[model samples]
Target: MKNDPNFIAAYGNIPTFESLEEREKWLDTLDKIYTEVNDNFEKEMSKYFYPNGPVIAYGYTIDGVLKVAIEKGQKIDAAKENELYDLFSNYGQNIAVKDVPLIIVYEDLPTPTSRTSSWRPIIGGIKICTEKPDGIKQSTLGFSAQTSSGTKGYVVAGHTAPSIGDQIWQPTAGPSANKVGTVSKVGGHYADASWVPYSNVAAKIYDTDTDVLKDVKSHENAAIGDTVYKSGITTGRSYGSVTEIRTSYDNPLGTLYRQYVAGYNCDGGDSGAPVYVYVSGGVKIVGIHWGGVGTYNSGYSTSIFSPVSGVQSDLGVTPLTA
Candidate 1:
C-alpha cells in the first residue's frame, strides 16, 4: 500500500509495506467487520462490490486509537462506528497508524487582536507653555506640551517647568538640530509646553523624510474604542485599544488636564512618548504621553495625553518641511 503511486501522491512517500499479504489481511478483516454491522450493512456491501465505494481501513492515529473520520461526506452508520471502535480496542494496539492518511474539511477562524501588528504616528513634538507661574516637577512618565497657538511639544513629565530660552533635547536621532532646541512657549496643567528650534535644529534632528511631524500641520485625534500606538526612546513600542477619551480632573501634584486614551501598559521612561494611530501605510502621531492612572499589568487605566487639535489651535506652528 505504501508503494502505490496514487497513495504516495496523496499522502507523500513512505517506506514500502513489509508484506503485501499481511496488509491485505488486515484490510480484509476491517471490511468483514464493517460489512457485518447492521447500520452500515448496505453501504458496506455496496462499497465491497462497487468499483468506487468508500474504503474502510485505518486512516490515522491521533493519540493511541486509529482515527476513523470520513475522507469525504461519505456517512458511516452507528454499527460501523461501534464495530470499528471494538476492532481498534481489541487488536489494533500495536498497529502503526502514522503512515495512514485522511482527508479533512477545512474551516476558517477569526484572527486575534493580540497577534496583530499595526500602528502609525499622526502628530509630532512641538513646544508650549504653562498658564500658572509655579513650575511642575519632572515625572518618571513624562508630560505633553502645547503652545498657545496650538503647536505640540514633548514635555519631560515630572521635570521642572522649563523657561523660555532653556535648551531642550529632542530624543530622536539626526543632526544637531534634531538633537536639541530651546524652550519657546508654556501653558496648561503641569506647565507642560513646547519649545522651538533656535537653529535649523528641527530639520537636523527629525528625519524630514519619514517623521510625520515633517508634514502634518496638525496633530492626529482619536475617539473611544479607537486603536492607538506609542513609541519612545525608553519603551520600544506597543499597541492597544483606546478605552476612553477627553477627561479632566486633578492629582496630588496639581490640577490635571488631558484626554484619556486607554490601552496596554507603558513605563516611566516612556514619559513624553508619542502616541500614534495604526494605518495600513504607516503610523500617524495623534497625541503625546502625559500620564495614566493604572499600572502596566492591570491594563491601561485612564491614560492622559494632549490632543493634536489643541496643539495646533494653541500654536500656529506647521509641520516641518522636507
Candidate 2:
C-alpha cells in the first residue's frame, strides 16, 4: 500500500514509531508475518529449497524486514520471492536475498575427558549426568517444575543426556557417588533441552567470577541490543548482548529456526547453559546457551541460544523459582 510504514522500511528507510505502544503494535504485525512465514517454511517451503537450490534458507525479520539467505552461487527465483512478498505484504516486500546462506549450524567437537577432583554443589553449569566414567553436566538448570508424579524436575540440554532413563550425577562422582537426578525425557535434534526428574538442583547459577548468583524467575525473548548473561561449564559466567533473533540455519537433521545470536564467549562444555536477561534483583530466562561460532574480540564470534520458551514448550516445564 502507498505510504505504508513497512513499505517505507523496506527500501532501507527507517519506520517511525510515535510511541512505545506504536512500536509494539508494529512489532506485533512484524512478528506475525515472521511466524506465518517460518511456519510455512517448516511445513511446505523447506522441500522446495534443497541443496544448491534458489531458497537455501529463511531468516526472521531483522530491522522489520524479513530475509532469505541464498546459496553461494545462486539467487532466489523471482516467483518464490514474490510469493513471500505477497504473504508478508508490506513488510514481506522487504524480504531480500543475501550471498551467505542464513546462519551456519555446526556441532561442537567432543572434548577430551578431564576429571575435576571434588564434588561441587549442583547448580547451573556444573556437570551432572548418568553416563558412566564421565557424566554429562547440567546446562543452566534452566527451570524446575512440579511433575505429574508430584515430584520436581529440572531442565538441561537434550543432546547432553545420553538416554531418557539415565541416572544423573556429578562428574566427580564417577558413575556412582554424588547422584543428583535422572533424565526423565530427552528432546533431541531441533529441540535441544531435556527434562530431569529431580529437585535437588538449586535455581541459582554459578559464575566463574564467584560474585554474581543469577536467579531466574520468568522467561522472556531477546531483542536486538538487549544485554544478556549466561553461565556455562566451560566459559563460566559471561555477559553479552543480543545481536540477532528470528534467525535460522541448516542443521544435520533439518532446518532450525527462531534462534538468537549474541556476542559472548562460549565453548563446547557450555552447551545448555541458561541465557537470561538481568532484571531488578534477578534474571529472566531468555535462551538456553548452545554451541556458538568464532572467537571473542575477534570481530566474528557469536554465541547461539535456543529460545527458552521453545525449550519450555517442548519439555513442558518452567524455570525454578525461590
Candidate 3:
C-alpha cells in the first residue's frame, strides 16, 4: 500500500508535486478560490439582513455562523429581529442552536440626528429657548455639576440669556408653560457661558440618545489637531479635530479670547453645546460651543467654543469631577 488501504481507496487521486514551488503555487490558488467563494456567499446573505434600517453591521462569521450588530438603545422585536434564526434548518444546516449559531451584539452609539425636542432632564444636548422667543434665542445646555462646593447647575450660551431669573423652555415650539430652568449667571468677556441651576441635572451630554448618558469627567484644554466632538439641537452631533486653539472671536456681548475653533460646523441653535474630547472612561469637557464665522451664512458653518477652564474661572463655578 502507498500509505494505507483505506486512504488509497477514497483519496488516491491526491496530487503529487515535483517541487516545493509547485506545491506553493497550488496552495496560493486554494486560498484565493476559497476567499472568493466566501465573499459571494456573504454578498447573497446580506439581502436577508435588517432591511428596515438602523443596522450597524451584519455579516457571516468565519465558522459559517451569521452575526448582526445593532444600536444599543434600539428597541428590538423578538420575532422580527430574530427572523434569521427561524430559518436555521431551511438551508440543510443543523437546526440546533450550536450547529448554526447566530450572534447579536449591542453598542451604545449616537443616532443620526441631534435632539431638538423638549427633554425634561436638565442635562446637555437638548434645545433651550427663551420663554417668549424674544427674537428666538435658541441654544444648547452643556453638562451639569459635581463641584467642590457641592453646588449644582447647568451651562449654556451667554448670548442665549433672557436675563437672570428668566424662564428657559425646551423646544421653543412647544407649550409656553413648559419651563425647565432659569438663567443664573452670565459670564464676562472671558467666556460666553450662562449658568442655569436646576434639580434634574447630571454631568452628562448626548445627541438624540437621551436615555443613555455619557459621563463628563473633568476639564481639559483643546490642542490643535486633537479630536473633538459635539452635539447640538441645530447641527446635531458631529466629529472633528481642533484646527486652532486659543483662537479669538468677537461677539456682541464681548470679545471671546483663547477660544477653540473646530473643523466641524454649527448652526444658530447649537450655541453652548459641549465640545469635548473622549477620555478613557468617559469624556472631558474642553469648552462650551458659541459660534464661528460660518454662523453668518445660511448653512452649517465652523464653530467656536470657549475653553472650559477659563469659563469655570470667569463664572466662579466648580466643575464636576465624578
lDDT of each: 0.37, 0.56, 0.58
In terms of TM-score, the best-performing candidate is 2
Candidate 1 residue-wise lDDT at 180: 42
Question: How many Å off is the CA of 195 in candidate 3?
Answer: 0.9
Alpha-carbon shift of residue 262 in model 2 (angstroms): 2.4
Residues 200-316 of candidate 1 have per-residue lDDT tens digits of: 222111111233332323246765456766654333456676643322332222322334445645544444555666443344556556554432443343355555554444433
TM-score versus the correct structure, for each prediction:
0.41, 0.70, 0.58
Q: Per-residue lDDT of 95-202 in model 2, one digit per residue for the tens?
A: 442211112222222121111223344455555543544544443344445454556667776656646777656653355557667787765434466777765556
Worst 10 residues of 3 by lDDT: 5-14
Give the range of the ten consecutive residues with the poorest summed lDDT in model 1.
107-116
